[model samples]
Target chain A: MHEMALCEGIIGIVEEEARKRAFAKVNVVCLEIGALSHVAPEALKFCFEAVAARTIARGARLEIVETPGTAWCMDCSRSVEIRQRYEPCPSCGGYHLQVTGGEEMRVRELEVD
Target chain B: MSSERIIQVERDILGKNDRLAADNRARFRADGVLVFNLVSSPGAGKTSLLVRAVAELKDSFPIGVIEGDQQTSNDAERIRATGVAAIQVNTGKGCHLDAAMVGEAYDRLPWLNGGLLFIENVGNLVCPAAFDLGEACKIVVFSTTEGEDKPLKYPDMFAASSLMLINKIDLAPVLDFDLDRTIEYARRVNPGIEVLTVSARTGEGFSAFYAWIRKRWAKLKQAERTAQG
Candidate 1:
């Protein structure tokens, strides 16, 4: 699964931050995953435990904040919340939707000792 | 006892890959190369389409191919048979190709100025949608044999692709594939996605595909000239 690779990327960021901030150990890693980002939080958590082992983030608790998918409906001329990409506008029932938010996978903050 | 403090990072998880992809895009633009990332599910006949496209267009343009697979040089071998430069990147346990892998593979290819570079991504519809390899656009190859609801089931890939090539159209009649319904489903996911039907077996509809490539290449060249001036 690509979640494993993504976990590796997370560890990389964590280690880099550790070096830059002179942290000896990480206690928790905070992440922001969006609904449309195509990342499974459970799978990410499963992989993160394995990937974070033996690193500065060893035994780190992962705190994931999920954001809702949002899109701008061209037909409705308003913003709508969507759970998926192929969803139609709730107001006008049209597919002319431009994704406005919720495609992000970001490492927001870390709790360090 | 150590006191814990929150460190604000605020970085994208794919920032490294995105940066590398931007670098690859700059390199391709400077070299005047039109890059297309071809993606599809397994057994979608992506390699077959590439073989046919490269053989047909090689006479008019300098073409190079970068084939990605979990473990196989067979596609590259098949491409090399057409007397074109093809490099294979085996991703080992990886499911998809990343920008770092593509950048390394591209560095080993021959000089291809003012030409086309086709990156046949791993035959996967899911993971590849997340990684960008600095291609000008992504083309999804959909064979008629697959279920029409694939677009809805795998909306991310369909949404990310600019063009959807309905390949294996020769089998549509026998398979009872509803081309219109499939197009409708794809458009439901991506209203701006362009659609083309073709069969790599019969070489049908390839002329339109070639024409599409030429049109984009012309626009790229015009943009390059405008940037210079």
Candidate 2:
């Protein structure tokens, strides 16, 4: 899955930081896992541990913060929170949802010394 | 004197895989092989159809297959039994196969000879559709047992696939599948898309698929040879 590579990528960033004498232990890595992104946190955690071998992130902790799948409802003329891709606007039930957010997989922040 | 604190760094995680994928795609194009990345849900019979197709085409043309799965080299082993070159890519816990995965598998393939390669993407109707592995076609293989509403439920997959092969047609009489309506719905989602109904077990419609693949492979090879000359 893309999650393995994605998490690996995040670990790469973390490694680069550690190379520059940042924080090798990682301490904390925050991730914004959008609902529509189709990434399973548990699976990511598993792959992270396996791929992190011999790297700076071998024992580093992963803090994943899930982001709700949201959309911009053309009918409501507003951005509303959604639970899934096919979900209608929360405030006004409509199908014309232009997904403005969600489907995001990014490292929101990092705690390093 | 100033008291200041700053942290700046840039990094990419997919560096290795992405680079491998690009090189694989370049080699594929250079070798005159048109790759097809096939994706669908598990038990969608990606292997069965591939086995049948391989059996039918192994003699006339050179063909290769890249099998992707969460674990086991079962699919790759099966394809190899058909007398064609095959490679297995175990994703471990991955729910989908990315271009990077395909690229890594390419390294293990004997792609020096001009041939056709089929990448059986990890059985997933969603994520695989989101990532392009530089294949000439993305074939979505599904079965009648999985229900015809798959296209409606998985719009992105239906939209992403250039061809839809509704397999297990031999079981249509036993199921409640409306073959025509299913094709109609798929066409509505992807106009001008090619849809083929085949039962890999019954040997029905194999000839047509063989012809389709031949046309594509021939076109790619012709283009490659001409471009070289």
Candidate 3:
């Protein structure tokens, strides 16, 4: 639902640009969901269409990119790849977890000409 | 420029939500709070276990809970009756509690300075596994009544969990529940996951569960103290 609102904003911009360019078709859309983003891919897929309703962006094929969750462990004194929190540091049994990356949910790239 | 061009651009579906989730995770670590995001199916007895655990440990360890649901603050109210502060996040038709929701929910909780925070995610097994709420751990709950094939059926949840709790064991004998097979299947999918058998309703096998918590709590506090000193 949150992502749909965001996608609506994106679609608006895309629509404006497409209309300006006078594009006939949008073949595919490439999307990335950060591991820690907590956004459901399926739900996002459903919401994307809902948000794109009555726009120049209906029935566009969507490509999903899943990014992994990364965290910095104070105990290990190193960066770690993590899918969740409260998990013991894989390298060292430490509880201090600081997520460092893969928390970005954005349109990394798109397919249009 | 009447010609339409196929543009190849890579983007994320969850734009702001992901950024906020990472922000929340960083904030949690910087704050030295261990957050456990609990995911389970409906009637899996997540709240029941939390209530029992809170009731038992409230006197010793300071804790708080954040309950997520599609509607109603009913779970929060139930948690509040245990004498611990509870905050509710209404997803309003959203099936799962995302990191942004957790971050907002935590801001609304009371007395959460260096306490164990349990986030009971909305009652669904699939999407909740896909999202990390910046919790110190993700505890997936399953009840005997839910059947044992849950692990293989929902391998994603098993794969995502650090620990799985098989609750409602008091009724295990009444129902044809097989503990060995359940744990085995779960282990097959997630070899590293720690599975604990418990019954929140009758306190069966709770001693081991409490011991596990005590160990986790001790280690967490020790790390925090060391970082400070």
Each model's DockQ? Answer: 0.85, 0.20, 0.22
Clashes of each: 0, 3, 31
Model 2 lDDT per residue over B1-229, tens place: 5322223433324444546567767878877777888888888888999999988877776888999988999999999998888989988877777777787777788754666789998898876765667788889998999977787777667766888998999999989789998886676445546988899899898888877888888898788779889
State the weakest 10-residue window (summed lDDT) of model 2 chain B.
Answer: B3-12
Docking class of 3: incorrect
Question: Candidate 1: deviation at residue A15, Å?
Answer: 0.6
Predicted candidate 2 versus true structure: per-residue lDDT over A1-113, tens digit per residue? 56666777888777766677655465566676777665677888878877777777677677787878767777788888876555556787656666666666666666664
Rank list by DockQ: 1, 3, 2
- Cα deviation of B88 in candidate 3 (Å)? 1.5
User: Best candidate, TM-score-wise?
Assistant: 1
Question: Lowest summed-lDDT stretch of 10 residues in model 3 chain A?
Answer: A1-10
Candidate 3 residues lying further than 4 Å off, grouped into runs, are A1-27, A31-47, A54-59, A63-108, B2-15, B225-229
Model 2 alpha-carbon drift over 4 Å, by segment: A1-5, A20-36, A40-104, A108-111, B1-16, B70-73, B90-108, B124-134, B152-159, B180-193, B218-229
State each model's C-alpha RMSD to the native: 0.8, 5.5, 7.7
Deviation from native of the Cα of residue B127 in model 3, angstroms? 1.3
Residue-level lDDT tens digits of model 3 in B105-212: 778776565667889999988768756677878899999998788887776687678889999988888898999988877765566789888999789878898788
Cα lDDT of model 1 by residue, B1-229, tens digit: 7688999999999889999999999999999999999999999999999999999999999999999999979999999999999999999999999999999999999999999999999999999999999999999999999999999999999999999999999999999999999999999889999999999999999999999999999999999999999
